[model samples]
Structures are given as C-alpha cells and as structure tokens.
Target: MYQEITHSFTSKKSLLRTIQNDNIVYYWFSLLFLNKSLRATLSQNKNTALSYKEFIASLYFRFILVFFLALFASAMLFHVFSDIYWAVLLPVIALYLSAQKKGFKAFCNIFEEFINQNFDSDSLQKKTLYQIGEFYGDRYAIHSLVDTLQRNIKTYTYFFGISFVFLVFIYPINTLVTCLGLLTTVLIIRIYFNTFSLLRHLQNNK
Candidate 1:
C-alpha cells in the first residue's frame, strides 16, 4: 500500500511538470510568432528566407542563457544575504527588466534599419496603406483569420501571464513583483486589443 501510494504521487508530480513545461513552450512559441520584429527578421534575407525554426531556437537560446545567469546571481545573493526577500525579489525584477530591454533594443534596431533602407518614405507609407486597405477589403475572409490570430494571442498571453502570477504567490518574496508583473501583463493585453481596434477603425473609414 505504501509503495503504491508513493508511485502514484511521483507519477502525478511528473505529469504536472510535463504540463507546465508544455505550456511554457506554447507561450514562448506564440510570443515569437506574434512579434512583428521577429517575423520581420525571418523575412530579412530575400535570397533565402531564414528558417523559422532556427530563428526561434537562436532567440530561445539567448533567453535561456540570460535566465540561467540571473538564477546564478540570485543564488549568490541568497548565499551572501541569508534573506529570501532581497535575494529573490531583486533578481526576479532584474530578469524581467533585462528581458524587456533586450527585446525592445532588437525591435528598435531592426525598425531603424528598415526605415533607413527604405529611403522613399512617402512611397513606403503609401504602399503600406494600400496593403492595409486590401487586407480589410470585403473580397475575402481575411478578417476571420485576423480575429483568430488575435484571439490566440490573447489566450496565450493570459495563460502564461496568469501562470507566472500564480507562481509569484508560491514564493513569499514576490509580492511587489507579482503586482507589477500583473499590471504589465494587463497593459500588454490592452495594447494588443487597442491595435486591433485601431486597424478596424481604419478599415471602416477607408
């Protein structure tokens, strides 16, 4: 009886870990696919389209490298301070900020290069407008596709964000981080919806 119970507990633990890992992968994949800059990077090479798998792998590798580095730093902090609050909280905030900074930097660099290369700003803007108009035209069911993409984006974002928030509660030192993280997640969701709303408004006016 004792052996059976232990085996059942171990099996359940393994299953939960598998589910968590799978959710993390799904969230990360959705993030890469939804991000405009990452998508643009894939299209950078006209002669040969960059392999999407490789691109995602490269970025994920960078993220994991940084994440582990942060963990090491957190461990060192805990060792020295002997306090969970300062050690864990500081590293957690630093990790979040570092990720945001790196991502934004990449986006800015790519967007700047794209603008500089396209010297004819007027033509570029006109072409973009034309494409947008066509996308929202009634000829096809593109809106359905857009709606589905937006829905999935929101769903994945919430799944990951809420999971993180739940994790924050597990660690007693995560009070401030949890509140701020939750707020940021809400802001991100709002921005995504707002972008879609703006696009639809343009479609209506056009």
Candidate 2:
C-alpha cells in the first residue's frame, strides 16, 4: 500500500511538471511567432491595393488565425512525442526566428516609407520632442497622451474582462496567469517608452 501510494504521487508530480513546462514553451513560442507574423504580413501587404487601415485589419485577423492553428499543431506534437517535444520544436522555432529577422527588416522599411511620405522633418522632430517631454516631466503632454491611451484601454478592457470571467469558469489557473501576464506586459511597455524618451532627449541635447 505504501509503495503504491508513493508511486502514484511521483507520477502525478512528474505529469504536473511536464504540463507546466509545456505551457511555458507554448506561451513564448506563440508570442514570438504571432508578433513576427504580424510584422511580416503588414510589411508585405503595405503597398497592396488595399487601404492602409484595411490592410492592417486584414493582416491582424490573419495573424490571429495562424496563431491558433500553430497552437493546435504544437499541442498535437506535444501529445505525440510525450518526452522529446522540445527537441522537435526547437528546429522549427529556429527556422522561424531566422525568417522573422528578414521580415522584421522589411517591416522597418515599410515604416520608414510611411514616415517619409506622411511627416515632414520639422513636424516629426517636434513630435519626438513632445514624446520626450511627456516621458520626462511634462504634465500637460502626459495628460493628453493618457487621455488618448485611456480611451483605447477601455475597448481592450471590456474584451479582456469578458475573457477573464470565462476563463475563471473553465480554468481559474489560466485566468490568474493571464492577469499577471498582462500586468507584466504593461510594465515592460511603460519601461520601454520611458527609456526611448530619455534616449531621444539625450540625442537632442547633444
């Protein structure tokens, strides 16, 4: 009886560890591939006949579709391999990362083209200065930006709130993880913007 109980406990622990590891891997892989796909599709379709906003929306939907498909594939692969899932996934991920680098460069070119077409040098410079000021200590600019951000946030908040409530019913653990993930993402974005603002300020002063 003692040996049976100990064996069962050990097996459960191992299964739990495997699931945790798989979840972590899936999260990162999905994030990276989705982001790259977004950039790639946008850049590739930038000069297509579609209008800018339409093109963006289409690409956004496509990326979301691809993300779910890839996720399903990964889950299937994980189940099939049982023990060496990462080994199979690593090569595919590497190839994806390499392709994404080229796509990212293309995306950067599209951005440059857009800026060149839409924004004159002085206007662009002033916009940069304003962003820097807001980042540093300009209360007025900060307030203005915050108002704009808040409006956008409200839209996402509704969607996320609904999703969280649903997840709570189906998977409470996922709901908690999702909340923490969102918080971390927000913090990282805040830090990145602040750092970019400081760098711009330094460049202007020099």
Candidate 3:
C-alpha cells in the first residue's frame, strides 16, 4: 500500500511517516522527481514499458529503504537485551535474493499462462486472469507486481525464521515468543508454496 506523493519535495516528518505507513512515495517520488531522464522515460512508457534496468533499480531502491528502516527499528527494540543488530540484516539480504528468484518464477508462470491461452480455448480462470491484467495495464506490469508480492511474502517468512533463531541465541528464556516466531515462519512458508500451487492449478486448467 503506497500513498501518493503530493509534493516534489516533502518534509522529514512526511518522509518518515510515509516509510512507516508503507507508502511507496518515499522512494517513488524520488525517482519521479530527482532523475529527469528516468522520469521522462517513465512518462513515455506509461503503459508499463519499463526497461529491465529500471525495474531492478526501482526494486533495489525500495528494498534498501525498507531494510534500513527495519534495521533501525530492530536495533531500538533489541538494544535493551543484546547488541546483535547485524542479525536483523540477514532477512533483508535474503529478501533481495528471494525476490529475484521468485520474481523470475512468477514472470515465467504469467508468460506460460498467456501462451496457454493462445493455443487453447479460454477457460474461466484464464478469463479472470485477463480481467485482472486490465488493472495492471498489461502482463508486464503484472509480472512486476507479482514479483514484488512474492518477494515480500518470502521476506516475511525469512524474518520470522531469523527472529526465532536470533531470539533463541540471545534471549532463550522467552520460550513463548520463540515458539510463536517458529510457528509464524512455518505458516508463511506453507502459504508461499500454496501460491505457486494455485498458479500451477490455473495453468493446468487451461
């Protein structure tokens, strides 16, 4: 969920709020206003004709912004007990890796679905996907969006998994919190796999 930017130059309070609120305006506005060439290209490519370099740059920018914020918050919260702030970055690094991996898979799945539709008749699921594509401008945009989502979900699983291990190493006295983190990590992993399973089911149906 991203809040739209209202000004070319936003105040510090607004910037911090935007980050805390998960508002993309934090970095999106920077790309739109700071880089004239990229802005012009993006304006011309309104139909989601973003270049590969642009896509990677945008993803990294957003990821880096969130990573620092998470790192700061984790440090503040954990400073009372331990000084293992570096451990917070493990999940962030894993998130970048997983995003690239899952994002490619999602793009392939989406492309396969499009190809399947061409050779075979339109099924209910394919039609629904096409309709969903309308909101995303096209399949390319959908690929970007799906990739973002998959990476976020995977990162959450990574976060909980890391949290469980870190807590055990630093503050093993809190068994309840550690167990909850473990359960959350497992649950999210299951859901992540289910997303791919659903994609496969849709493709097979067609």
Q: In lDDT terms, how accurate is model 3?
A: 0.42
Q: What is the alpha-carbon lDDT of model 2 when measured against the actual structure?
A: 0.40
Where does the lowest 10-residue lDDT sum fall in candidate 1? 1-10
Cα lDDT tens digits for candidate 1, 1-206: 11211222122224234323433322322343334543554456542133444433334544454455456657766675445545566665576456544543443333334334433444444443223223323333334323344465667576666757575755545668777766766655543332333333334433
- Identify the runs in model 2 with alpha carbons over 4 angstroms from their true place: 1-78, 81-84, 126-155, 174-206
lDDT per model vs. reference: 0.43, 0.40, 0.42
TM-score of each prediction: 0.34, 0.34, 0.26
Worst-scoring 10-residue span by lDDT in model 3: 23-32
In candidate 2 the C-alpha lDDT for residue 26 amounts to 19
Error of 2 at 108 (Å): 1.7
Extract clashing residue pairs from model 3: none
Which candidate order results from sorting by lDDT in descending order? Answer: 1, 3, 2
Q: Give me the displacement of residue 99 in model 2, in angstroms.
A: 3.7
